[model samples]
Target: MPLSSTQPPTSTMELASPMQVLPSELLIEIFVFCTYNDAFFPLTLGSVCKLWRETVEFSPRIWQRISMADEGSIIRSRFLARTWASKSKPLPFDVDINAECADMILPLLAPLLPSISRWRHFTLTGEREEERTLLVSEEPATPCTDLVINFADYDSDDDETEGRATFTRQYPTSDRYTMTVWVHEIPASTILMPLDFTNLTIFECVFTGQHTHPLAVIDFLSVCPQLEAFYFWGWTHEDASLTTAPPTVHLPNLKTMTLKSTCMTRSLLTSIHAPSLTQLYLAHLNVDFQLPPYYSEDGDSEDEANDPSQSPSSDHATGMGLRTFLSRSRPALRVLEMDFSDMRTKDFRFVFSRLDVLEEFLIVASDMSDKVINLLKPYESCDSPVRVRLPNLKKLALYNCQRLSGDAIVEAVSARAEYTDANASSKLQTVSQVEVVDCEGFTSRHGQTLAKTLGNRLRLH
Candidate 1:
């Protein structure tokens, strides 16, 4: 974009100013700072001054981020995309494009097609199948490190609606390039194979409805051998009618995984082996809290849910699958967080015992019982000879654990805080901080008692 001759010329006094004497490198850095907080830097910094505009043009890093919001015109978006693509040469750029303008803007991104190989990260938000197809169709032979796709018109503020989930692919108005075709299931084929999932290290897929199948996910995972982080939100579940299990897909490099859907948890946890996994977060929006049957410390149990022969759809299947996964992976887990889940006490014991190095544990809105306290109870005082379950645990938080008694909470914290060896040395399992929030059976007196015992180490809310 060249400066127009009609534009005002610099004043003679301003030309002699100290600001005009700054080096080109310093000026380019200043332009970067002007737009460092924004993803659309090229659009704003190109019009500053003749020298500054040239500096921005010469610096590829300054023009490497491209973001298109919903409020831009098609012509403007196309112009900005072309300008940035031309200036950010030989460097991989992070691209974020909202799907709302796909009809008008996507086709005009032809100038950027040849440079797609330099894309480091691609985020497509609220895209329909056709727009996604268009993106892949134009993509060059490049291997992106991160990819995020939202298959739904997702409103993060909206609560989960009732009924079977569904994906609704929307397009522009009929006068525009509208797509009339609709399918009951997501075109999973477009996701992995088209964009080449083999190179992706971090991937996230979110959908509106229960359209994705477990087999589709398995297929996706099979291709992503280098994936280190995988996150899925919304209806990624297996059809209960599908009794046959898919072959287990191994992700040897995967380290962080978050599954926020119940069905997805049940589907993926049982199917994937991630030997390098260390961080896991699981949440289920619709889990019924049924107390698990009692089992001796040795884990002998007769409950149907506890039986390994039970079907995958059983109330405890997800938890059981998680336990099996942790056992198989044997990851040096340092952080574990579970929320809004139905995992029972026995499942907790099974999972916790395997994580010998877990240093941070956060459990919220789960069907926790007194057994949870018993597990967290300092190992030195236990009747059994097993080492402390979480000897390395430094932080513990329990929120909305209604079944756990206040007395049990007190005892758990006291054990963690006061536990010491015969030589009066502090045990490694000593919890430095404890936070309890929104749980029943705790009063101000209980808070005062804990505060007095643990001092400021305890937080009661």
Candidate 2:
């Protein structure tokens, strides 16, 4: 019954064959998905066979996305450097320095800086003073296109101020294309470096303490002709501070801008013109204005009016610079979020009139007031509405506001929907949905009322 010697084995008696190997292209594709965290996988693959090591070594796409930290030891680092040099391809790399082992790691990285012209994203973190000195040294590799400098802290005793000052002074002279600098527990004065990023598209500067003259920062921003996004964070005091208004600096290509601190005056906002801005985020601002208490003509009193503390005041208030800013650059704004948690009710109403074409409006307040909610309600009216029109609005979110009743909110939304459907000239009504979040006293009654009013056009979360 055994098969003949010249005959092939019968199908039933045949031995199983190995699966076909994946093509080299497919293996490279899989390697592309691997990140710095999975670097060991590639390293292990390269060591498996001569062909795999050759494939991994010559693939610039593979080495381009590598993290310098992936090489575990000095020997490994040197090996990686040699591999990178042999490939000689521009690599998009991210170098993250391990703060715990920076002293041992930095020297290894020093040699690779010369080839950093390929870098698209670079992040460095270590002991504050040590990392700053290392970064500012004359031997920095060619300035990268996108750079992020981060400071590492252990016990918070590091002299962050001095470190940041040194970095600021050194950074302006570097030929970096785009940069973001983040400093923790450092004052603005520590940023003594000149701002000379003429080709920068995105810039973010964060500090803890108030600057005597924030205009210096503004002056630095003035040099960037192509800057697109700018963010500023800090605290400012009124006394003995340089309050000179910044000259109007036009950011024609700017798409987003954010400012977070205490209250900012109208003059400050008006000074920066971003013709292409689509999104704006303002937080913890104080605007000095207040609303009058409701008084019934019949001598009957509402509970709120009976309490003197409930009456809003605008005496100490200042105007938001948003109004003047929008008057000139209103055509491009599509999304606006303003958090006036520190401002009085009267101030919110004045600023609300400035967001003319807002499609997404998010307002966060400290307390919900009937008057303030009523002031906002007219934007939804099908008939006479507020000065600011949101014809394209699709989503509106109100947070921490206690004054608006759920019923009132639903009614306003319904009116707005009706108005848009009937009056919109384009035949397709723009607004289709609305949302509200984290209102303090919102309940089932409010939810039901809102649903009934908005019908299919509303969602609650």
Candidate 3:
């Protein structure tokens, strides 16, 4: 990292450069920005001039971030790691190495990986299982504020792929290194149980296949009691032989939750009591619309395939679980979005009966019908917001609601739009926007009626 003899000696260095005249603090920042103490900075910046050379020699904070990506030779990378760590002493290290051979690089980093001070950011992204061992086998002395691990070869374009699990601390203190690792297989352990889940404000986990059990996920949510936003995408159904009730956990701080196609969808909703939840998005929760007209919403049929909402597997909590979670949490939900759901009308009724404070409701590819739309028909002459069915409901959007008719939706919107307060003041629950998309029965006449009533607030597609 020394200046080569090719450059003139320090005493005869160029004198009129702006960089040479700038304050040492600004110059050091520029150095840190040029390279986060990578292999190139020392040789490049140190050889820039005598002032730059002295600055690099003296700044430890500038060497704080030691990161490398895709090095051809692991041996050369290891040498750089040791040198960077040695230079970044007395400062917390943020070492990120994204390479095919990252599993081997960790051992070379040694005690730095485990130092409580080095708990700044340790991360991996979708590699082999050997890299997953880094998640906990050499656990840090203290749990880091931020840790990201992807246990699948996740592709954003593919919905079937296993997704990433991210655990990030809302307030990260750079007192130590942070570890973020992405491994291809879920670690064989109890998913790093020893780490402190309380530090996480946002926790996301994906169970795309049968490799992860429901209990592990349940146990995981139980520890993150302070989570503000939780996302779960489980695709596997329980084995028929493994029927058991999953324990529920109360997430008092959780405000937003998104659940996607999964058998444990109901179990998770049934198990978690998120009283503070305000935004709820459920997608493909129940995927069957082939039931007979006489079939009961209770799913009393002996054949399981007839009712996709009915879990023939060990997941005893049926589609009713969605209703249960909503009614129980009783959070003043502001946004409720359900996509590709085949949930019964009664489930919709349950939600409508409970969430009077809902401001926006978007249902896509749902089994919503005329009866469901009729549920939003609040009295036209109500002088108070409290008397309305959905007093806070202002935005209504229906997408691919095959069973819904334009007349029912238009009637609902017209009835709900009448503020009609005795004080001549608009009620807070009045309909402000209505969007109807891909509903075959939603004709142009319905669009005109709603357009006259809602003006630009009406969106017909």
lDDT of each: 0.59, 0.51, 0.58
What does candidate 2 score on TM? 0.51
State every prediction's TM-score relative to the real structure: 0.56, 0.51, 0.57
- Local accuracy of candidate 1 as per-residue lDDT tens digits, 36-91: 57867665666877766777778988987777654645557667877787777766
Q: For model 3, what is the alpha-carbon lDDT of residue 183?
A: 37
lDDT of predicted model 3: 0.58
What is the clash count for each candidate, in the order shown?
A: 3, 8, 22
Q: Which residue pairs show collisions in model 1?
A: 165-209, 165-210, 166-209
The TM-score ranking, best first, is 3, 1, 2
Top model number, lDDT: 1
Off by over 4 Å in 1: 1-142, 152-210, 236-242, 289-315, 379-386, 420-427
* Model 3 agreement with the true structure over 23-102: per-residue lDDT tens digits: 99998878888774363576577787777778887887666666655446545655666666677765665656454533
Error of 3 at 399 (Å): 0.9
| Of 1 and 2, the candidate ranking higher by TM-score | 1
Candidate 1 lDDT for residue 71:
64
